[model samples]
Target: MVSHERENHFVISTRSYQADVCGKHLITHKPAIHECYGKGCDRMFPTISGMFIHLESGTCPSKITLKDVNAVVAMYTHHNSIIHSDYNKSLAAMLNREDPPDGFPFHCPGFTPGSLCGKRFELFSGLLQHCESRACNHTFGQDDGGLLSFLHKVLYSESALFKLGRLKANVYSRIELVFPEVLRDGEQEHLEALLILLQMLFRKLLDIIENVQSRLKAAISKHINYQILGLSLGHPSNLDAITGRRGDLSALAGEYASITGNEGRIAGPERMNTSEVFVWNIDTGECQLLHLFLEETTAVFEILSLETQPQ
Candidate 1:
């Protein structure tokens, strides 16, 4: 799945159609063209247009020094892989919470014998026995063990492959390890460009998370109202884990409780019927709509900024 190509310094991954250039798979987010070409181009070009044409056409300005395209390819591929691992981990976390597994294996076959071996074996045998007794129904459950196994593999497999030394050396070797010589030629600018891009990416991620949190909060509020029969029943609670850690929603919830008092309670709990279920469904739909909107927006911004370094 992971391969090195002589034509391009990048370690190509042909594992799947969905396999990402670095680690990310979204077709809309191919590696930034500028970042890719700039890697081997001169530091100073009067205009981006000049830079673009020179790189696109494989032409070089007489005054500007250019490294081999192999170096550029290496940097692009290496950085992409690092970013992919990070974003993929985050995505996995979100998906796992929304769709938890139905069952888990007691013993992890992938775990090697070592300090945790005894514990692992016990746990493993327990799950296996449990599975056999249940006719392997656990395997078919939503919480199947396969997901856990895969997670383990991705998190630990090939620990040496992604190391800084390996990635950096491989990337540098694209031009016969000329990165050091480039450094002597003023690598500071290149380093700065990389930092700017990474900073921009970090900020964008924060925006995405904040947007999701805000929408999630609203959804929670609506759910509470539908379940309790009215938002008038209680002040908004900062039930959000992020808000709670900062003491943000707690005081507000208290204030709301005081204002609403007993008036917020549904007049008849026993009288509530299946008709209210329809209302809950509607609220759920609205909540999901908000989340979807935020997600799309985040993806769009990320894609747009792919090639632009932070200003």
Candidate 2:
């Protein structure tokens, strides 16, 4: 039998079959949310078994055995239901058009599942959850190389942090492909800042991967238990090389490679077939006027260019 009096943490009280002594504040099946539903009112309740009672019975006893309680805690924390919930809510809001366009992505455009804006929110939610778990919020928006710097370093190490980099690239490519047009000055700047932070995080992950890979090489050569080491020595470079050969693969390394500039020339040169032409005749007769207009325009442009040519 195990019991805790801490208000912040849950306690499990055990009684064999049905024998127990009562203590003050030690209420059984206390008629609160958990009493009524076997779930905590606050949302910090952890454990599948703890929740299992909530699922099976309308109410769970307040006092649970220490063994059952620990089992619940291990499963719940390992599964990370709380963090998943937070991330899901963020993504759902973006996907469902519930979030107002605020600092970044200034344009909602509409709810397209495969759109850049949607993808950004999705990846952002994931990254945000990871940051929260690591308690990385304190450094956000701080000047003099604080949180922002930390995030930047994390993003830039993408080559090493295989998973983070892969996820970021996926999101980045989706954005670049969908929103390949000029953005407002403010929006553009905001996107740049966001990319910087993402890049920093990615870079850190890469460094970790590099270290892991070095260890992996040594482990394999020396017949070490790589699995026991629990390191993330990654094959990101090899993976990248292989994936790069695929026809569907795009150059996702470049930031905003598809974000348009002032002149509106596409950021990446897209090969287009120009061999096909369509001609229409207004009166089923030779329409020489349109051709003449084109010729005159071309000649005038040429004359202007030649006269204004420098040296």
Candidate 3:
């Protein structure tokens, strides 16, 4: 084969010469059908995946990058299986480096029946062994460099950190998260108990909030008019001291508005410089406290109730 290649042939058919060049044929034996829509790159390929390889290999005259292709692909929800976003920046940086770090993230993004998918490995080689042994079915490495192209783009652009493409996950996948081993030696055991207790507290807080919301909802349904009987002489001068102390109060006010036929929505929250949001205000000395009550549906004197009872 070397001697045959030593002498150049003058073949009449350009196609035959290329076919028998006995060299690397980047193009497949399949028919040319996948036409690239890239600028100045109207060349066709046997398959769409081949065209992607061409684009990502940085050989196309169009100069369209892998990140460019990935960004566009992510906009299409149906193609999510072939794309990823909000990826692990640390892993991407390691992959883009010439001499990669010793450790892998060691997470398998798979969950097949009885498979060692979604399992974390203690060592980089352990991860390789897991994939090689068909645990998670070689989930990370089986994409024909389709997955590596994602990280390789980091060499050219920083946006590569959050976006990856040509990787597969289960059709019904959870929100992709990078649950790293953020603790050092001995930290896990010490912190895990406190973390568990914190989680329980969070559950209790959630339950209390749920109960509060339920009671508020029930109160609104009862159609009872609420009246502030009167204020003590020593009552805090401003509503900020008592009424608006809680962060949820504004949201509660919005709920009140929504139930009382007020359709206004708050905008320009970014402009707020103060802690309290006052719907209406006057000179500091002229302020007064009022109460809210349901207008009786049957009463003729549904006179807007603005009873300011100050003691």
Model 3: runs farther than 4 Å from truth? 1-28, 78-80, 83-311
Error of 2 at 85 (Å): 27
For each candidate, what TM-score against the reference? Answer: 0.19, 0.19, 0.22
Computed on alpha carbons, the lDDT of every model, listed in order, comes to 0.27, 0.28, 0.33
Ordered by TM-score, highest first, the candidates read 3, 2, 1
How far does residue 203 in candidate 1 sit from its true spot (Å)? 3.4
Q: Deviation in angstroms for 2 in model 2?
A: 24
User: What TM-score should be assigned to candidate 1?
Assistant: 0.19
lDDT of 3 by residue, 167-271 (tens): 001011111111234434543343333323322322223322334434333443322221211211122243233222233333433443443334322222233
RMSD, every candidate, angstroms:
27.4, 24.8, 24.7
**Per-residue alpha-carbon lDDT of model 2 for 182-216, expressed as tens digits?**
44445444444443443343343343333444533
Give the best candidate by lDDT.
Answer: 3
